[model samples]
Target: MQLGLLYSGGKDSTLAALVLERFYDITLVTAHFGVTDEYEHARQAADAAGFEFRALELDREVAEEAVERMREDGYPRNGIQHVHEAALEAVADLDFDAIADGTRRDDRVPTVSRAQAQSLEDRHGVDYLSPLVGFGRNAVDRIVDAELDVEVGPSEEIPRADYEAELRAVLAEEHGEGAIREVFPDHDQTYVHGLRE
Candidate 1:
């Protein structure tokens, strides 16, 4: 079956791709709001990972709304969660049998509840999969170490194609760079280089 995986060029997403590699024809897709060219980074990672790649355009209004919500909330969890749901819905609209993401069991945000997953599947007529949802950080890290090469650093330093990047750009453009720092705390981000040889 054909599957579209929401990819961010990060370890979790990349590892999710690897886990699903044998079961489906996977296309690594990056959802972007057209606010920046960061999607190109995901494209490169897809190439290195040897998967078909596509940049799916998301509604810019969603980004705008998410940024506004983040600004008001003074944190990114809700806004980021909103974008992630939108992204999953967007991916479900594609002509694939399944849609997947890298959200894990332990993640504090961006999680899809069982009801939400069922709703997505029921509405879209496609299975929604999250390959890493059952795995903890240690298990995921061990698999990533065995299967992929990654670059890890502070969030701003890492080149990535995820909601956070576009959100930061939008937040910065409208509010200011300081607003970005205010909304998003400093955390490590990862960029996958490729699978191990």
Candidate 2:
């Protein structure tokens, strides 16, 4: 089966792609919200993993909507989820049997609810998979440690295709850095700097 894997060139997404490759023909799909460097990084990661790569450029309106919603809600919890759903919807037209993301068991935002997953499958005629959904942070870390070599850094420092990057940038610029802090809160954000052999 051909699977469109939503990739961000981060550890979780990259690892998910690797695992899914054993069962399906994996196509790494990275969604770019705005002018960012994530597409290139994701492409490189796909090359390193020996998987076909595709970059989907999301409409700017999607990012604008998320940002506007975040400004109104005073938090990004729901805004990011909106962006995620948009990303999944963006790939609905692709010729694939399934669409997957790296959302883990511990992920709060950008996670597809059971109802939402079912709705996608029902409406799109494609399966929705999250390989890491059953894995916690510790188990995922262990798997990454055992199976792949990777470099990690602060999420802001690492350039990967992420909705949050564009959202954070807009928030910081328009509302100041404090707005970013208020919306996202304190979290240990990390990204894969490089995927090693």
Quick one: best lDDT, which candidate? 1
lDDT of 1 by residue, 29-113 (tens): 9999999999999999999999999999999999999999999999999999999999999999999999999999899989999
lDDT of 2 by residue, 8-117 (tens): 87789988987788899989898876555657877887777678999998887887788879988988888888888988987866889999999999998788889999
Tell me the lDDT of candidate 2.
0.82
Residue 94's lDDT in candidate 1? 94
Worst 10 residues of 1 by lDDT: 173-182
Which parts of model 1 are misplaced by more than 4 Å? none
Clashing pairs in 1: none
Worst 10 residues of 2 by lDDT: 186-195
Give candidate 2's total backbone clashes. 1
Error at 129, model 1, angstroms: 0.5
**Maximum-TM-score candidate:** 1
Score every model by TM-score.
0.98, 0.89
